[model samples]
Target: MFLSEPKTLTTSRGTFSYREGGSGAPVVMIHGWPESSYCWEHLGRHLKQGLRVIAPDLRGLGDSERTEGQEHYRKQELAKDVISMLDELGIEKFQLVGHDWGGIVAQEVALAIPDQIRKMVIMNIALINNLKGNMEVIEKVRSGSGKAYWYQHFQQAPGLAEAMIPGAEETWLRFFLQGWSNDIPEDSIAEYVRMYRIPGTPGAGANYYRAFADDAKRWGTLSDHVWKIPSLYIYGNKDRVIIPEYLNHIEDCFEEIRVEEVDAGHFLQEEKPEEVAGHMNGFFETD
Candidate 1:
């Protein structure tokens, strides 16, 4: 994504495509839904000089091969694909960065191998399981999310969101990209539109939302688990769906957390790349 060609690796799950750039401590960057590794293009440029940016197109999203089954979209299952890919790539341990769905998957990866990640940075999304039994947070998020997360319900299970994507691909894609952010990257958006034009890609994207139930249940088993890893969370204060209130009780889940709230929308990195990268570089200690 950062002026590097996309590389392919075959795993049991499917053929995954990723971009690798720079050389130093490895930093795996995971992108969120409706956008591929290309979304990291801007942010990766700044850190690539001092860090190895490994940005993978989540299965069925970018240049990666789409695997069958709705279960594949579940964040835990997606995390497995990432771990296996890293193992095969011969990366022992590394830092992590994730946005949107990637943020959720990054949590799964951290939880699965707390010892492997030197530091973790997550943006835009909140890990709900961390909230556990806090009724106030639980109630607030449920009501607030109901209005914001209406698309989740539409995309989950025999949802109609994917059906709408086939003919009006750009319309559906931009619905989130343009609406969720104050500034939209035209190049990245054009690339995303081209990718979604592929047959079956829309369904693959929708399946991610379809696995909400499975993701919740999987994280439920770790309802009491709290990560002690020094972590940084980048919050987009103006996010329409994942409102700022999600920031409440976040400290309860992490032993040490540094939250940087940006005056942007859900796609904070895209809206404010230079500033976002600055926050990340400072937290990650990269000059």
Candidate 2:
């Protein structure tokens, strides 16, 4: 199967829920929005054979407790939750992996505690600043074109997303799951819908995007900072949400980085778990 049963930790942030299995150097897996730690089930099953795997549902996303206010969902604050969870678990150093918004949080974690992370893998996320020189891509995403990321803009607007997304969560969640992946299993989609249906769950997802301005400001303030950790950048060639073109500026942001392209779409771990886990194992195992 995947791993041991879920465990809960009361951290400085709130009650954090995670799944852990195997033994050895820890590999913390952070899942992105609209999905829970369940997203890592397949990848975790493989990685757990050789490495201790820790996958946590980001605050307010899955079984984790929801903290009130948009500020609680800021990327930096989310990073703190990861750090707090590690503290509670008594883990000192570990490898990190994240997808989508989770990738953004991973970047923040690395920035916050560079020494705590050994190697890192960021999947299907644009970690670089969009305002730097990617105006064309930014405009396309904002205008809802072929590579439209309209949801980012949509979620930033207060009350609108919360009002529209609650009751019709499944329909909205399925649109992204189907549109972003080559063919996600219906059961996976149903599981995500079930989680989002929890009272106040949809709002927590929206809060991640709602904190975009604060995240952007915090990112800009740290623009001169560069990530020193060895990093692997994995992206799917067919990922419409975060197009491969977004990889253009990654080198400028990180000191040591390598790029890999897969044939799947945005939800690469779901569509190509073996490939994703293979890359992670290779990078994390090497010096």
Candidate 3:
């Protein structure tokens, strides 16, 4: 098991790191923020039937090379990293799966190269268009249930994020790693903490949050075109960051969309790998 560290690939953009395993139809898995390709390890185990899974750490996060500015971490640019690495690998067509921010980037990839995506699957993430409405809901939650959007508020001051996060990286990660999923492995938490402990990773992770407005505007440029490919949305019923209210109009963005809710929290794949992989496998394998 190449679990200790992932393999690296140098593309035209820069050198990026990824973990690839198994063989057969290509399946690229994109991990979310504060998570490297490591988050997909649990689900990758079940996808060994006939799938070659390649999980990439989005640019600036995980072990990927990072540029100084937060602006370089926008979703469109993140999507470009994935596209470049795949192109370098000579992968012309493949299935796509993303969780958290990766889900949003997957949307960008689907939009950019729709002809190359055989199918798509996303978990616990809102599309760029839905982010504006999501913020509104977050405010209502803040006033009602007091569910704070600390990350958003904190990342609003990127400088502070870089300064403060490093000292308390483990604590911050613990809140999400232990709190978000009921069944995430202890080793997974340790692995993420170890990764974040590397210099600049904390700031790079924050860059993703810092680029929210830029992502929304960048994604806005590719509007009004509906995706015709088959896509599946796997939602975690217990996710605190995103609620059912946010997905009310997701159908408008795609031609064929199916939503499957799992009995878990934000890290649904980590919490329910079998169920998550089952849905993805069934969806991708079917006619």
The clash count for each model shown is 0, 0, 0
**Predicted candidate 3 versus true structure: per-residue lDDT over 1-287, tens digit per residue:** 52336888999889899888878888888999778899887877876477888888788778889778877788888899899999988999899998999998998888789899999998888766554446566567867856446777687784887788787878989988778779688878888888888888877888888888787776666456567889899999998887776676778767899989899999998899889988887787522
lDDT of prediction 1: 0.82
Off by over 4 Å in 2: 128-136, 139-147
Per-residue lDDT of model 1, residues 1-287, tens digit only: 46477789987767898888878888899999889888888877776357888888888898888766898888988898899889879887799999999999998888788899989999988674565443455587666546666777777748375567688888888889999997778998998998898888988888898888787777667657777889999988888777655676787788888999899998888889988988988877443
**Which ranges of candidate 3 are over 4 A from the true structure?**
2-5, 129-146, 220-223
Q: How far out, in Å, is residue 165 in model 1?
A: 1.0
Q: What is the TM-score of each candidate against the true structure?
A: 0.93, 0.92, 0.92
Task: Give a tens-digit lDDT track for model 2, residues 195-273.
Answer: 8888788778889999888887777666566778898988888987776557766688778889988899989998888
Q: Which candidate is the best by TM-score?
A: 1
Order of the predicted models by TM-score, top scorer first:
1, 3, 2
lDDT of 1 at 7: 85
Rank the candidate models, highest lDDT first: 1, 3, 2
Better of 1 and 2 by lDDT: 1
